[model samples]
Target: MSCSIKRTSSTSYRSGGGVCGGGSGRNSSVSCRQYASSVIGGGSYGGGACSIGYGGGMSAGSLAGGFGGGLGGGFGGGLGGGFGGGFAGGFGAGGDILLSGNEKVTMQNLNDRLAAYLDKVRRLEEENAQLEHHIREWYRKQAPSVSKDYTSYYQTIEQLQNQIISATVDNNRLLLDIDNSKMTADDFRMKYENELVIRQTVEADISGLRNLLDDLTRTRSSLESELESLKDELIALKRNHEEEMRQLQSQTGGDVSVEVNAAPGEDLTKTLNDLRNEYEQIIEKNRREVEQWYEVKIEEVNRQVTSSSQDIQTSSHQLTELRREMQNLEIELQAQLSTKNSLENSLAETESRYGCLLQQIQGQINSINSEEEWLASIRCEMESQNQEYKMLLGIKTRLEQEIAQYRALLQ
Candidate 1:
């Protein structure tokens, strides 16, 4: 006889009984067999099977079974093996008692054992549930809390970046200003050099004018000496004419008469006076001309010399001012250069410090990312473990139900 039971879900049970010849041909034997199957969570479990044989008033039995389903198949197989081994040992020990012809006692013993197994399954299920609870608690406790706020760090970085940018701009501007100052200084230097050359030329011209003035002064002195000598010669000639006229008068005063056929000689005194007057007039006129020429030349030379002196003085003053101004510009430029150097140094130091800070921040960010990844992996592992636990729990439930059914059948 065979009987089969089917559930509305994917579970089934089958039991069969038959009479057969024993290994000893003179004896007859009875056999009973049961098979159960179940499905849970899209996986099927091949439930435990029990078989018994009776022959020549001696009973022998064997229990062999396995659970077949899991998330990946192996976990249920291992549990099934352990449970099957335990059931096999129990059945092997009870097999000898069946020969005493107490079927009810054997059935009672099997039912009690099944109850024990049920209790064990209950305890295991409870433990599994507790473990799941603990796992959830662990996840709750160990999971990372709200991530640390990096808004402040971001703001600080932004401010630092802005500062660096502004500093860079200012540094560039300062460098440009320094360059302009250098160019200006070079231009001023060139102008100063040109002005110096012009001053030298003016000084050289002044020297030449001074030489020419000296020559004119010497010529004026020579001309004055010549005029004085001419006057002395005129005075000497007048004295000689007077002496000759006196001798003539003395000769005439001695009462000597001379009969001469020539016209009366021209008057010596009149002729000599006329000659002196004409010579005096010419000398006076020449002296006035010479004096006027000397005056004109002296005035021209003096004016030129004075103008040249003024120009020299003005050029010297301008050169002095330019030198002073150049000195000031040089001083200012040096100060600006020094300022630029200091700013550059400060900028370099700031950049280095900020660079190190950024590196540290990046390292911190990397570490945080690594930690997050690790946490995610842990979470995934936990989830997998929880799923496995759930599968095992389902197996345990099905196993408990099978055990209950086996108990009902035995009773």
Candidate 2:
């Protein structure tokens, strides 16, 4: 028997029994073509491993450990090309040229057995190719997905955004309201201050008027004292006049008449009586004039006091009214302040409540994001596990088929 190279249209294989990278064909790049069905791995070249694995179809699919679908497509190339072109000397006496005549029978039996193994290998290879094709199609068609549709979540996000916008607008409105309230409070405070100032001014005027009234009273008292002094002086003058008259009368009652020279003494007692009469008339006129002047001054002072008292009473009433108004204003201002404070407190509470709500919403959003990430990771892990299961299933099925084929071939 001898070895020969023949080309086949449906398949090409390398013939050898050496592993990859352990032979003289270390850099050999071989290719195999299986043009039987879907043309997968057809006319494909592989590096290193193909040199010893593919051997003109002599090396079975197991030459590259196991047929791993298209992932091991290069094994076919190694099987068809590795040994036929590069494993002649490395395979020792396994070459056809080294067989003796007696060894032909043994070789024939081995060849038959190799043929059975090769048949099993071919079946496994075809299945592997089919599985590879199915897997490729699945990979090409199957969409890698992390999660389901999140349209509802998007709508929820939009709703949250709308809520946020509305909240912002409300906050601004509340701020405006607060500003208005503050301005109103300020205006009222200013009015109260101005009114207070006016009240103080009115109080000062009232105090001044009271002082004037005191001065007027003092003037009236001084005038009354002067009138009393004038009356006392008049009484003293009259007493003295009476005493002189009595003395003069006593002296004339015992005196004898005597004529002095020169016009008969001109009647001295008569002249004295005329002088006393004139003096009494003048004193009575002075008394009348003083009494009239005093009465006039008293009447004028009374009139002034009455007018001043009326004015003081009017001012006092006005001051009382102003005080009442001030009190009312103060009350109203206090009420307004209380209202403002309540409004501010309500606003603060509202802000705190909204802040908590917003924080909760943010937490929910973060949780949603974290959950999404966790789900994505789980999805990826599941997908990876599924791929591994499929790969292992394909390998297991192929190995079982190969084992069954080998058993049958042995039997």
Candidate 3:
């Protein structure tokens, strides 16, 4: 069987020599070096049994060495160094410097492929940052650095929450104080009303006492007038009795008359004197008692009026104090309510701010995760391609060995 290995460089290797000779008189095929290095040709093959396809037209294959200086850097260098020198010492000793037709195209293609691979390797360099860092730190750097920092936001929120709690506590306390103050004021109002009622009653009593005093004065005056009239009547009766006694004396002066009785009924003048003294004593006693009673009533009324006045004053003072206290409590309650409203608003704003920040952080985390997954997939694909290239290189090496064995058989 005869087999041929054809390459892009217009070079060919066969599994059989031209005739029965492994080293035939076939001129070498010439090529040029264009890329960093150009090596075209596999190891030579010897003749085989049954050469059915006719002898491999043994042409002189002049494979050109290239300008590659490093190890495994040229085209097909992954196989071996100088694969063409398979027991034939390679091609013509010193070939032309220009590139042959097919070899030029092949070198150009190889160089382009190599350059593309290198570019892909350079482009595949890890551009994404490491994934092991803190998420907050990464966000701080990648996102707007001037944005409000969420790291300290936690502490600020806690402080605001604490302030809200304190304000609530204070607001509750103020409400309680307001309620208590209202109750106290209500109680004071009730007491003021009761005191007012008592004052009114006392005033009515005083008015009644004044009326009684006036009536007592009128009665005393009438009593005095009646006593004066009685005295005048007694005086007139005495004068008439004295005049009758005088006339009797004059009439008895002409003749001496004597009369005798067991009892003179009573001495008229003496009885008159006794009656006058009793009436005068009774008038005096009545006048003294009425005047004393009137004076006592006036004193009692005065004392009560003074007591009511003091009570009214006390009630007024207490009422005024309660009113002032209520005003103060109302003011305090208003202040506390305002403070509570402000704190509530601040709390709401803080909550909204932090909520937005949290959402942004979550979104960033998701994006980072996706990017890492993409990088992982790319790495996996690169590894797969590398493995495939290694496998192909192995296959090419095996094919070259088979050709060399064929050449050995021909020799």
Candidate 4:
């Protein structure tokens, strides 16, 4: 059997969050933050391995040691007080004093492997240093010092709110005025309708009076025709009496004068005169009665026509007044309708303006949500890194302890 040993000045660490590693068991997480120091080294058969991490600020440190055979070999693996040291070894079945050629070759191979591991460690150190520098730069960039000018924004918001409130109040006042105007117009319209009905009724009555006047005119014409016929009858009677008297006088002129004793000549002429006077008096009385009756009927008809004319005049005057009033009412109603239309236009503009403002506010809220999600992802990454650091520190501690025990055994 042969023996080999390995050592390190600092601890080693493996990290696995999304990283895969040995034995299919996920690698432990690691971090660069300073809290403790760990030292570790181990050797195993068939390429078994050990790892450790040193957790401390990156301070200047060094490691130096030697190994020998015999009594000097026992003193070789001692530690100095700068950083911790580590050792790893494997033993094969062989004499203690003599090394086989194969064993020498194995040792040489191990030495070469250790040299390569050291080079890799150096490269990792440089990379870690670069990462730390980048993290510091990033911390500076993301510092919470550059605050936004939210004070100005708040003032702007308050001003907008006040304007909106004022606009709303104005809109309400306009609406109230519009309602009042509409009601006034309606009242006027109703009055106009009532007056129109009255005018129509009065015109109908006037037309009725005109028909009555036509009937009276026809009656007057009939009475005048009857009076002409009576006058013609009186003329005819006087002419017939004159002709009979002439015939009687002619017959008496040829008769002989016989001395006949008569008591007295009958006064037939005087009797005839009295009878004519009585008939003329009766005819005059009847004529006066007819004239009085005609006068009375004419006066009554005139009174009815006069009353109808007065009523018609009064209705015409009222109709004129009502027409004027209706014109005024229509004008006022048109004005009110125009005012309502203007107010409706203003209301539509106000609503459109508010809708645009609401859309802008919603867009701002969406942006804030997106920023919050990005910040949360960064926080998760930082937590994962911190956990890796702790696991690496634990491994380092165990390795230091093993090295100390081995040193004691050599003594």
Q: Which prediction has the highest TM-score against the true structure?
A: 1
TM-score, ranked from best to worst: 1, 4, 2, 3
RMSD of each: 13.2, 13.2, 15.9, 11.4
The total of clashing pairs for model 1 equals: 0
Residue-level lDDT of model 1, residues 1-411, one tens digit each, is 111322111222221221111121111111122222222222232322232111111122333241111121100110121121112211221111112234345456555555554565567667767866887788779766676999988998999999999999999999999999999999999989999999999989998998999899889879978987897888788788778888888877866788989888888788888988999999999999999999999999999999999999999999999999999999999999899999999999999999999999999999999978987887797687666555545544555555554444333
User: Residue 389 lDDT in model 4?
Assistant: 36
Candidate with best lDDT: 1
lDDT of 3 at 305: 64
Off by over 4 Å in 2: 1-226, 259-322, 352-360, 378-411
Residues 1-411 of candidate 3 have per-residue lDDT tens digits of: 012433322223332121112221211121212222223232221221111111132223333444221111111111111112122212322323333465456435534543443343334322111222343365456554454455675676577568667766766776676677667667767766776676677667667766765765576567557657756765676677677667756775966667786665666557756866776677678767866876786677668667767766776676677677667766766776676678668767766776786677667767767866875675575566555444434433443453455344223
lDDT of 3 at 74: 13
Name every residue pair that clashes in candidate 4. Answer: 1-92, 1-93, 1-94, 2-92, 12-52, 29-388, 30-388, 30-389, 31-389
Error of 2 at 157 (Å): 8.7
Q: How many residue pairs clash in each candidate?
A: 0, 27, 12, 9
TM-score: model 1 vs. ground truth = 0.60
Judged by whole-model lDDT over C-alpha atoms, candidate 2 comes out at: 0.49
Candidate 1 residue 58 Cα shift, in angstroms, is 29
Give the per-residue lDDT digits (tens) of candidate 2, residues 1-411. Answer: 011334333233333422211212222222322122112222222222222222321233332222222122222222222223221111211112222353345335434544554454456457756766676576556534454565775676677667667766766776676677667667666766766676676667657755765665676577557656656765676576677767877876765986677664476557766876776687677667766766776676667667666766766676676667667766766776676677667667766766786687678779778876875775686576566445444534444454344344323
